[model samples]
Target: MDESLRAFLEALDYDGEPFGMFYTDQEPPSGFAPKPGPALSMELEQSGAINWQEVWGSFSCVIGSIWLARKKNTAAYFEAARYGCMGGSFYLGFHQPQLDFITHYVSTGIPGTQVHGERYLRSPETVRRFFTEIAPRPAPKRFCVFKPLSQFAPGETPETVTFFGRAEVLSGLVFLASFVTDDFEAVMSPFGAGCSYLTSWPLHYLGQGRLKAVLGGFDPSERKFLKTDEMTFTVPYEMYGRFLERWPDSYLRTDTWQGVRKKIARSRDAWGEQAGQGDGKD
Candidate 1:
């Protein structure tokens, strides 16, 4: 992380430093990799019910692993062969045209059967259309790593920077994301998993060379992994750099932000977070 950027966010009383997403061949240190899981496709094909235990061992959501990444200040990565879930494999760019069962799984399951649906959407067709519209891409490398920005090595560049924060912190970031751009849609909230908002959608904008920020963490299924007040904001890494450079000239330094800062302090108190706490409470 740039020292100046760190100072700026600290001044804003942002809870933690933003983390970065990048691709590398290197595996994460032992114990940081997600618990080994069975192939989702095979499990669904054979049992009609997911063995959540074998699928993720101790944690189910990929976002939980990400929270661990931020909390421990270490890298956690996903590979094509070992990505934790079907949704993760798709959103993290390991696969496309995700498992065939996804269409039914997200909506209504097979009629009169034990394959109950999550019912996230009205119908299979709607879920199919959602996937078609988002159009996830394949990853550029074998390993997709999420590391705290401060831990990035020399010459390492992240594809995107993601922040997990409450509404107040996100408000400042949202404005900064748009402060330097004139585009009407500088920030977007799309429908998808928490993991998708953190990586896939931001990568989608990066691929288009657009400096859009993604607001996510609305996925009910993954909410259990996050703090009660947390949501996510992700921008292309280049755009994050622009935020760092322009924030000094933006509204962050003004008295108005000071009011927000007070609110941040109050929130920290309510959440039992202390000032100068390590990174954040995630």
Candidate 2:
């Protein structure tokens, strides 16, 4: 992590460290990989009972594991065939779901299959259109690694850097992102799975040669793994460097942001995040 960015985040009272995602051939240190197997089957959806332990042999939500990685200060990774969820697999460019079931599953129910719709979209057609428009890119390497920014070694570049924070922290991030570029839509909030925002869309913008930030964590299913107050801000590494260059001169340095910082302190104290720990700034 860059020292300037670190200090800026600290001053903002952002609680957690930012994490990075990258594709690599070699495994990462202390990385948590999805359990080995044939991957989840839709047949299990219709089965009487699912012994998930017998199925995947462990807890498996791609975003959930990423949460674990952040809290534990470790790394999490996924392989092409071993990604746990069919939706996550598709988003990660590992493979498509069987018979395009994700479309219906995310929208309307598939009648007679025990598959109740999540109602995230209006209809299956809407989901299909989403898939068509996004056109996620395939994984570039054998292993997709996610770890905290501090863990990244020299020569290892991350495709995306993801931050988890409440609205105040995100506000700083949003303004700083826009300060680096003239684009009116410097930050984009697209509808997607938590993993899609953290991984897919940021990479998508990078692949298209556009530098933009992605505001995410709106997925209802993945909210359980995130703090009640938290959302995500994901950006391409190049954009992150721009933030490093511009934040010293941005509004983040002004008394206006300092007023917001006091509110951040209050929120953290109310939530017990600063329990008994004096940051010494007070």
Off by over 4 Å in 2: 39-59, 97-99, 275-282
Candidate 2 Cα deviation (angstroms), residue 246: 1.2
Candidate 2 lDDT by residue in tens digits, 3-82: 88688667656776788899988887686777764554446445634454554464378888887777677898998656
Best of the candidates, TM-score: 1
Q: Which runs of model 1 end up more than 4 angstroms from their true locations?
A: 38-59, 278-282
TM-score of 1: 0.89
Pairs in clash, predicted candidate 2: none
Candidates in order, TM-scores: namely 0.89, 0.88
Model 1 Cα shift for residue 181 (angstroms): 1.9
Clashing pairs in 1: none
lDDT of 1 by residue, 1-282 (tens): 578877877766776678888888777564256655665553365476756556546344678778777677787788866787778888887767766577888899878877798999999899989887787777888898888888888888898888888889889988888886756689999889889998888777777777799999899988877787788899888788788778888888899999998998888888888865634554
Model 2: weakest 10-residue lDDT segment is 273-282
